[model samples]
Target: MKSRRRWRWRWEHRGFALGLALYTLLLLLLVSYMLDYGARRGRALGDWAWEGQPPPAPPPGEAAAPPAPRHEAKRNESEDSDEAGPGSRAGGKRHIYLHATWRTGSSFLGELFNQHPDVFYLYEPMWHMWQALYPGDALSLQGALRDMVRSLFRCDFSVLRLYAAPPGPRDPLAPFLPGGGGGGGVNLSTASIFGWRTNKVICSAPLCPAAPRARSDVGLVDGAACERSCPPRALRDLEAECRKYPVMVIKDVRLLELGALLPLLRDPELDLRVVQLFRDPRAVHNSRLKAKQALLRESIQVLRSRHRAAEPRGLPRRHPLLPPGAAAALAGVHPRQQHRAEFFLGGALEVICQAWLRDLLFSRRAPAWLRARYTQLRYEDLVLEPRAQLRRLLRFADLPSPPALEDFVLNMTRGAAYSSERPFLISARDAREAIHAWRERLSREQVREVEAACWEPMRLLAYPLSGQEDGDRQEGGTVPLQMFV
Candidate 1:
């Protein structure tokens, strides 16, 4: 009996060991499958990352026929010709970069592209980049900025989310919830404008399953699952849309140095075109000053409110120059002294003129190949002759001028009136009046100061000298073209 019991126990142990081995094999298989699936997904995402170099030029005489007369035919012909090069045909899309300075009527020019049915327009995607690496903080930021722009051109906005994340607990705003939540909770609405704008644009697109959801709730569900699912899916949708559209346009005023972006123009995959929008330097300076004055008033009000709040809390005030007692004293000072102090302390107008000069110099020095792809448009020309100028711009961009384009120009400027005060909005009424309105607003001394600071650029760009030039000459005073070089 003892021998039989030993034999039975051994058999039972063998059976248990066999089951354990089988389970281990099954777990290994499952893990392997998951890893393979992830690899596949990653590969798919990378396929849309960048279009390799452009295709070699066709042999002489092998080029496609010239565009036909009909608008649709011309569009088709352009597409066919573009396909001759690999870079241009990468998913079949054309790209435009609208480079401008602040207060240059760029907002209105951007709207022209935004209103197009066939165009996928992005407004200042680099705003996130700027916020991440605020201009003067780092000198090595250009490479990173260029990479971000390249990703965006290919419809990969996932990188922008990294910059859009909320600040740490130490952030002043972190303690208050704008939506009535308790302290230490984040307010999605106020966290990052870049994120909010990105979310709005992504959710508004047709492919987002979460399109109906509110902007705050987007990509926040199911923890990591939503984060993983939303961006790739939206990017895939954007890629498909890019294939359908003939052109993609990105506009930004922060790209003051055109030379930094020349590399992108040379990229085969980008097929990039540049529209450099400039305004009269004096006008830009005047507009910037007006904006500063308005901002100063708003800031003064906010400072008073903060002082009122801090007094009850027994907290120290933040503004060194605007102490509670000093606030009243400031009102009695001359407005000109106040303006001078603001500009001197902030280095505002000087920086503006310097930037204009820097950008104009960089544009002038661009190489021949880069210049071939570059087109310059004046804010005055655009506002004064919207239809004609826009038509020229469209042709330069290699875009067909459909009836919709004409309607957009007309409708954009028809109802609104010009106002030096409202710099942010598009005013379609009286383009010529708006063009020369700076003459009436800016003091002669201020104009001369601007001219002295930006003499080379002002002369190069043909902006007439204020009050010093012949009235009969419509263009700015002539300087030797060699001076620009």
Candidate 2:
């Protein structure tokens, strides 16, 4: 009996030990799972911070939606303004922003809208703010830029006077003079508005006697004649003309971040829609290289803004060499100094790519209102299929796609010859040559640098990496949509 009791006790202890070992194994797995989950959650939160919003949680048991179809991604026109704020009303004028950086063919894109008779288009209105506040970091100037954009959309041209006026003891005509009241500020007028010479509205009828307005008018404006005929008009008169149009569009390169424009996006009265244009970074880099001298100041501002953002608040440091008044002196920089400008401009491309990545990621995770109000466009696609792309653009802006507009787009892309004489000139050009020109113009090393710096956005934008055939033509690649709407 004593022997049987000892064996029974030993068996009982062995059973308890076995159960504890199993429990410990299970506990380890639970802890490991919790750690992994925490890591994934942290990464997701970091990404959401880019856009300032977290994506909505998925429903239980729902598989994640597949990547958006090409057409769905491009066709983001949301007809229901139910989500649009209280200021939204039926039949309100549509406001559009042609969001692009400098020299991405934005001038040509804006020209398309400018030629539309029913549209009132302003080109680079923020240019006044940028020029007025030169040496101000781009990040610091965003508030003023946003305000200017908001006011312009409302047809309150008076806001321009804040930046447009000569900085010294104010003279109304100071903006018209070569130097702002002898302070050497920008020369401003209805005639001096960026791209005003090519503006159909400014060049036609009520604004100028150069050409009579016609419903079928789709020809490029004769900029020389327009400059000769159109005199400076009062701000109030410009506003009056602005009011007559059913649609208002502004093209700007100064607004760097999509998040910066959220307030405008939320404004119901303005009913803003954005057509954000992107170009291959390699091409943009090539173009910037060609126009480096002209773009130096802007490039400096872009770089300084990025550097300033990373500093602790109130650090107050500025580039020792780049003083507020030093911009005027860049024109005389010695040949050796040109390398410094090139280096600075190269940094600017990185800033631009960073901005592109931020905008793209934000748009992808954006809420319904944002998704509704935004559209993404590629410069390559625009030139490759002008007619189809133009129709889609007009559709997004609620404009009619007329035959004259079609003809205008076709003729603009097919020119007599490729010319770099007027790099910034808005005229017909050989589209194919323009698209492939960078291949020959950029050295292999230069191409590699641009690709290396911009690889993230290049991938997201579907641009093929160097030496790869365009994915659009490759197996398993998407076919370009014949129509977006």
Candidate 3:
């Protein structure tokens, strides 16, 4: 009886041990599957997120265009230099950022700068990465990376906008879905705005994220506050960042406005160089009218509002409601064509965008970039004299104006072209008159309203005020040449 009992006990013990081992192995396998699944899921989402839409299909029998001529390397030169070499980091002294505003001949200027062998011309680095939440405010390092990672998981606009940073990019991607500047540097500079010398100084914010658990109840304030709350060390870090680079040129328009950018620019330590490019207000407005965008309404409204207020040459802006003021340079500058509400609103949009632009270029922002830290160039002048303007600009930026620039100009004009489109475009009159073009659809009252809306900005950019100037000149300003550089 005792032996039989012992045998039963042993059998039971063995069965229990075997069951426990099998269960452990099952758990391990499950965990492994989960880990693999998670990694693959993350990668799949990432691939989809970054993949751009495919090019439009060509019809049957239409061959793709022939390839352009490739540059043959000279035997003496290092091949790697022709492309961005592995040793390129050794040559990267400092970045030269060209902050190109929309419709402001940014590409033309970019190609021009790219002519110099040493200058690293970065085209809209920040603009390309925004998945859906593009056109957001400025940015920092950590926040930008988080947004990029989050963009992979979904294509939600509210979700996307939640992740945008206005200035540039931010970093960190361990866990994602984030929205997230101010400079840490402060230089007290007296700036004259509207003939009043206010002690217009900008203060900086340190670089740090807002508290992770902070609820997203309040929108802009939360963002601005979080930026404000950034640690002082980050501000110091940014200042130090510019120091390591020998010279950097930045040209993102999101940070261009005087009120928004002045504080960031007032850093005493930065020896920044800025180039302000001006487009004809009419052309700018015309482009704005034709632009198909999501967040553009706000910008268009801002433009239209400004145009209705002032004329070019410090003239009083026209307002259907406000009426024209005496000695207003912008008075009576209505286009002879019926105000195509959508198109002629260019008059309004140009007037408005240019007023602010004038302020940005010649006013407070101009002086800031123009300060020992900057240089200024006009796009009209550039189109008029690309070689001379570029050479002078190179000298101003402390870069050599290479003879190759002329050839570069030719190559860029004839060869390196990306899209066949005007840099700052004005819609042809017939198109402006079309039903979809906003001609047939717009009422005369609407035209007058838009014209009134455009009146101010027209005055500011010096659009022809039919009041004094003869309307003989074709389309307001100097006849523009090839704008895309």
- lDDT (tens digit, per residue) of candidate 1 on 1-485: 89999999998989899989999999999999999988764332222212234334655664565533322331233334433332234443578999886677887888677655456677666666655553332123444666667776765555566555455122221122132111112232222222222233344444345544432231221222323334333333444444445677888765434555655776667778888887877777666666665334222322232212211011222222332432342343332444643454234434444445555555565555556677888777676568988888888777766676676676655545556344554445556555666778876556655655555556567665544356524532322222211
Query: What is the lDDT of every predicted structure here?
Result: 0.53, 0.69, 0.37
List model 2 lDDT by residue over 217-264, tens digit each: 788765555555667666555666666566889988987776667666
State residue 402's C-alpha deviation in candidate 3, in Å: 0.9
After the best TM-score superposition of candidate 2, give how far the Cα of residue 93 lies from its true spot, in angstroms.
0.5
- Those runs of model 1 whose alpha carbons end farther than 4 Å from true positions after fitting are 1-89, 135-140, 167-243, 293-355, 358-368, 414-416, 420-422, 472-485
Task: List TM-scores for all candidates, in order.
Answer: 0.59, 0.71, 0.41
By lDDT, the better pick of 1 and 2 is: 2
In model 2, what lDDT does residue 484 have? 18
lDDT per residue, candidate 3, 92-129, as tens digits? 23334454355555656764553343332333333333
The full ranking of all candidates by lDDT, starting with the best, is 2, 1, 3
| TM-score leader | 2
Q: Give the TM-score of candidate 1.
A: 0.59
On lDDT, who's better, 2 or 3?
A: 2
